[model samples]
Target: MLLAALIGAAGAVGAAPAAEPNTQVPAGSRHYAASGFPDRIVASPAQDAGSGFAVAWRTAPLAQPPLLELAVAGDSPDMGQVQQLRASSQALQTENGDSQHHRVLIDGLQADTLYAYRVQGQGSWSAWQHFRTAAAAGEPLTVLYFGDTQNKNLSHVSRVIRQGWQSAPDARLTLFAGDLVSGGDGEDDNEWGEWFAAGGWLLPGMAVAPAAGNHEYFEEFEDTPQERRVLGKHWPVTFALPSNGAAATASTTYWFDYQGLRVVVLDGTSALDLGTAKAQASWLEKVLEDSAQAWNIVVVHQPLYPLRAERDSSVLASEIRPVLQRHKVDLVLQGHDHTYGRRADDGASLPQYISSVAGPKQYRLSPQARATMKPTAEDTQLFQVLRLDDKGLRYEARTATGRLYDAFQISRDAQGGKRFSEVTEGRIPQRDCPRPVSPKGRDDRCWE
Candidate 1:
């Protein structure tokens, strides 16, 4: 069923003609282009919270079977005993060239343990990277979150991701609210490579949870009657996610429990525009209802309350918000507005909504955002660090240069009611585009 959904999502966009071997490669991106050596390695959490995890990577078609070497990290530099596990590979043909993607799933490990692993390239092996499994339930945990990195991933957004890691080096999981790349058509392999290069070793060291953005879906053939939006080819092979989501959405929409937090990822692009809203909503209700973790948070690409006045995600607002409100979700991390807006929960029922951007792209804040969000910003690239524990949740937003831009805290009462408060002592001044004196060309004043 998973395979079928993946294929369907890819094929639904439109079949592509065979690629010409002479496709032009973008400048400065050749260093990241796929080769015989392993690249784009990513680590993801398995369904078994504390016991297992998965890793995926890309390389040219291998002449020999791929292998993954794993061992428990110890004080000794030498890996005393290593377990060699065979990996499965699938051939993927993109505009850049033909490459093979490999994935290995490791299970039956001890809980809350640190493990070091490396993958076999063509003739050599990659440097060993380390990742720790989720701690036991109800333990303190830290997480790093980012909004859309849809453009300038290599040159600009790279700093934001590295700064995020520097800010929370011990963070267990890194969550991306989608639009990781700008290419809507599935064939833009260079953009994907730049994205991986931007993350470097951090992607493999921390578990990743990603949601799908609309930019991840595009029409293969534009302006034709047969044109239909479909999922990108790089998505399925880039990250190995848990398959415990709605059947229709498969790997793109899923959830995993990490150290007392139930992090649910939804496919807003698939749900709102692709006719899977009801399925996702139903599955979400069940997931929220059955969550046994101390807190529940959702990650989606599209914001329920959009930051740009011209944008409207009415389907998501109507179909998904009710379920979240009914379940009393703690927080929602979102992207797609290319701006920053954070709204705390009202006295009544809405969960805290935050829309942010990590890439160079920016947009103007809408009137709704100006009125509701306390400290909205435009033309700013930001990253967030979220720490959750028995005491409460602490969230801090920082600029690309690693300055504190915004801070907030959420504390829960004995009855599980949440109270939100802002930390404005050391935060930088709020940034917004100045209104143009001449209204004729006002649209060109801010990032649009």
Candidate 2:
């Protein structure tokens, strides 16, 4: 395996036990500067929805007044300079932090056309970011998925993300499973630079969809003026997205269709386990029932079918998974478990889970769950790359270097159920992580 591959899913990673008795690291010290990033950007990182596209980004300390300009991208990436059409923004204070958010909607865009845009805020206007509107009829496309880039974020985190881009340069979107930052006391801030680096120019190079993971929260970490003044600021101001996906609200929860694929996003924090479960569940049922696309995918911060019994089945299983199975959702993507993991079909989930920092790391198994639930001494760093083509869909679990670890392909049957043919990059058997070690025992405090 390539070193990159070994660094990713194929390489071994140690358990990320919180408060690991590290005298060297300060409490939440790693992320104190997360909000310092020059910008926070969100685009309809999912496939294009018809006639529309979403864009969002954060402005710290509140833009005197947030603003953005929308326009079409130049064909040559330098040609058609985007013409500013309109702009809008808002301020949100969450339990975590405070931030200013700006979003703009553009219309009259032709189908399958690439539209580039830029944002304007206090003392600055952003470089053009581009996205395409959904095709009238869906088309096959490619997207990238990253599990957890939260730990030891910095330039290293960007390395994992950049490889995905290098592997699929023309991908339609990048799917972020959450924990973009370490939420505990905002130590995740230090790594924001790496997050941006991972996307590099690709952030605006292509769209990115980031779910809110458990670590994204700000749990009354401090009564300090700074923490109390801003919540969800960094996220909203950073990226832009479609306004109509989920009840058309600004929260990260919503759904959009790219060609035949229907991508649905839920606030696992809100719908799965948090108080929003009842409401999000109802919304999910409606969204899944209403979807007209052939392929349906769901995304959330937590795993619906967690691999380890140590952790509870993510809130979504009780609150959401049934809806997916009922709707026959094609793919479900997540990140909180940290370890790179996936399921071939809507069956029982694999026992393997990967959680690691972004930097190079060796893999280590957690305490065993059962005689049958131990991770092999030989572990690999893992990640996933997915391709959707005219014939069928291909999902590969790969490590950091770019070697395929686990593979599964699904073609549609006349009955509409997926016919799955599975493959592995190398000739290797499966490895299972320890049963869910003890729960992180995180309360719903920050979520509230």
Per residue, candidate 1 scores C-alpha lDDT tens digits across 1-448 of 9988987876754444222121234544444456878888999998766988999998988986699999999888899899999988888887667889999989898889999999988887888999899988768899999999987687778999999988888898999999998884433687788788788888999998889898888875679877767998778888888879899899689998888889999999888777898899999999999997778999999998888887878999888999998988888999999889988556653478989999876778888879988678988889999998866888899999888999888887767667867788889998886544212344632542
lDDT by residue (tens digit), candidate 2, 365-443:
3333223332222234455677885457877665567665666677866556567665654735554433333224332
The lDDT per prediction is 0.84, 0.57
Give per-model TM-scores. 0.89, 0.73
Error of 1 at 135 (Å): 0.6
lDDT of 2 at 2: 75
Where is model 1 more than 4 Å wrong at Cα?
1-30, 184-187, 344-346, 413-415, 434-448
